[model samples]
Target: MAHHQHHNFEVDGVDDDEVPRNKCRTCLKQNTLTIATVVGVIMGAILGIILKSTKDKWSEREIMYIGYLGEVFLRMLKALILPLIISSLVSAIASLDLSLSRKIAFRAIAYYLTTTFAAVVLGIIMVVAIRPGVGHTEMATKQSEDTRNVTTVDTLLDLVRNMFPPNVMEACIFQTRTDLTSPSPNVTDVYKYNISFETVQNTNILGLVVVAAALGIAIAQLGEEARTMANFFHNLMSVSMKITSWVIFLSPVGIFFLVAAQVLQMDDIGSVMSRLGFYFGTVCLGLAVQGFIVLPLLYVALTRKNPFTFISNMGEAIATAFGTASSSATLPLTIRCLEDKNGVDRRVARFALPIGSTINMDGTALYEAVAAIFIAQVNNVPLDIGTLIAISITATAASIGAAGIPQAGVVTMVMVLETVGLPAKEVGLILAVDWLLDRFRTAINVMGDAFGAGIVYHRSLKELGLLEQSSEEEKFQVDKNNHIDETAQ
Candidate 1:
């Protein structure tokens, strides 16, 4: 196998330790921003605790304002998710030749499906191991007219149905980009991160993925005729990623504020931590293992590439997703990360990732699987192996049905509960504490996409000799390849 050059420039004459100083300096700024954001969360949580605990009546008004700041952050990030996916994907897949397209799709889909399956299994296992919901007392359930957004027997069927274009105008009419809606009269008390329709249980992200993939395959199959449109999308993906990279450099401020805000308000932080701690703990453990372990392993099995190199290149994209908490929003960054940072062939990264974004959800799928089983345990329902297997499949697809935002997993859990015939009301229990876990799951979902791209691209590059299969990473480096022109360098 051969290779292509990868570059990171430094100010001349700098010591090796001093080399990372520039990058390190930026990291320090990011770390500082992260600390500040965590402080903000702490302060806000404390303020909420104090206001609720000390006063005769808490100001709904103050909660509204504070919540709004979080909303603003979500909105800006959400605003970028859809276009980033749509444009980047169209461009990425379209530009590939048929030889590359097959390799890209084959490996990407394999990585996605396998890793997703593992994530959900892990989620279910961890939750069952800990039984976070078992023997747990709870706030009384909300009054139900049975009109709430719970799942139904028909929900999975409906989820598949919704992905296709019932009407071309639907995306715009429905506000496809952001998940949260503006607050108005009756919706005032709850968090405004609205994700579901009152009557519908599924959003059919799988349908959208199917459509995009069909289009990409068609374009690739058509050759020169499709080249113009393909190039247009490729360019779009490229530009979006450049923008994504730019956005990445600024994320420390956003993350810091977001985290700080969460931490600032701790009323019996200990008790709350103790109470919901397992839920958070399980989610984190699952995501960390899936994101860092399972997904990387999938890459190695599929493409035989070094996961560390893939991780190194994908840093900016992953960081952006962690901060933004939306894969669609991170699309630009993910595409850029695959092509620019990692040595993925352009065509493969474009085609697979966009499709993966809509359908391949390692993190959300895992959360859904775990949450459903946990809810079943709380309700004292028995889950056999068959049921667990069903859950693995349903949760995998349901993750695509779920939106990529706060509380998305809970909403998707509605579908999973229905699949296993659990009382949909149990979802409210999970919902009560889902916000914190949602962020971690979203990052897991993005990692799935990043790793999927890496695996597929690695396979493609290997076939083309764009990347060599080394006996070991220590034995090879990209600079040895002539693909990167030295004069152009």
Candidate 2:
């Protein structure tokens, strides 16, 4: 063979000879955020342990001071959420035709329900097999005085009520919650409960989502008349995203203080861990199976791509979810990672993510299922197949209604306990470890949302391509007609 020399040519204004170096630099720059987040978590833990070991005990106010930065970061993220959800959902749905929008909605909901059910089942299997609470019956006798008198029906009704808030503006700041009060606290009659629905200081996300979807649909139907409105929402979404990006840059510093404060606030950690170690391990195991094995498999089966690679690309979002312990807080990063790093369509990311953050709670479902069973074991309560089935169903449903905030699962866990005749206050048993577990499960929840976006994006590719082609053709025809009219004039 004759010797030959090849010269590299520039493509897209970049020399091929420097491509490898450029790629390496680009990758490092991209991952800087993930690296810093990891470092922040590690440093926070180290600092907390150091503070905990000191001779002087830390006060509540001191711990609050430590977490002030984290609190500000959280508030900033939440401040953007109302605008982000409204703008993103309205813009995403308005951009699509009705049929395509319905198809995507159906797929997203189907994926969410399937994954959540699977998670509940997996958690049941883990708790049943591990038997983490079998030997802890003694602690069950020490019950707290507080009991949630709400029934499953009441919980279900609350879910529906929150979905249709009476006032759109009120939904921005409050969600409806049913409270049970008794005129006589000393009287121990459960039937004497009086129910009242009152607004709580929480964003009615479900209601807002419903309103946004309707607005988007209406805009879509009005055709060209609604162009200005649609454009307004689209521009609003862009501005919200820009603000979100700026907030995310503070994650490392915020997370450091958050983790440190959490550690400083712990009480008798050694004793709590000794008693709850197996329970903690079991919940962690279930989350790992759901987040790592189950979700990734679903993604691979649907997309025929390496799911781990997709997960790897979501490092920053997952880390933020863990550090923040709120999927709602982590929403901005999730959307960014899905669209920018994973190559998901903007329409799919925007449409699927906000809804997923609200309803798709695989981690919460698994944790609640496991915790309910674990509580049963702790109390030596005999549970039949029917009871177990009720637990699974209730856990799945409750997880859907569960808020995307830290420890929201604790509130819903009471319903699961009461459904099977377990004491509502038995939740106190898991309170000590719930803080740590919340972070893990929140990370899994965010991962599930990201995977759902990827799956929906993969499944809707053909429809999206068709929509794009039709849009281009319509634009061409409009321009042609305008040209003819101009020439005639």
Check candidate 2 and list the clashing pairs.
Answer: none
TM-score of 1: 0.74
**Candidate 2: deviation at residue 244, Å?**
0.8
Clash total of candidate 2: 0
Pick by TM-score: which candidate is best?
A: 2
- Could you give candidate 1's per-residue lDDT for residues 1-489 as a string of tens digits? 122222223333345667577788866663453344344445544555555565444355554554555556566666566556666566656655556567757776776777777788888888878887777655344432232433343456556556665653454224222223545657742244365443233233555555666677788788788778777776765666666555555555555455434433333456666766777677788888888887777777777768877775666556556655677766766776677567676666667777777778888887788778876776678889999889988898777666655555665676688778865676665554455666667767877887777666655665645323432443544554544567568
CA deviation > 4 Å runs, candidate 2: 1-14, 140-146, 183-192, 475-489
* Model 2 global lDDT (CA atoms, 0 to 1): 0.91
State the displacement of the C-alpha of residue 67, model 2, in Å, after optimal TM-score superposition: 1.0
The most accurate candidate by lDDT is 2
Supply candidate 1's per-residue lDDT for 375: 67
Counted clashes in each candidate structure: 29, 0
Q: How far is candidate 1 from the true structure (C-alpha RMSD, Å)?
A: 9.5
lDDT tens digits, residue span 1-489, model 2 = 122222232253466678899899999999999989988888998899899999368999999999999989889988988899899999999998888888999999999999999999999999999999998877744464447587887888899988998999999989898888887878665557888887878888899999999999999999799999999999999999999999999999999999999988888789989999999999999999999999988998999999999999999999999999999989989999999999999999999999999999999999999999998898888888898899999999899898888888998998888888887878889988899999999999999999999999999998899999998999999999999999999
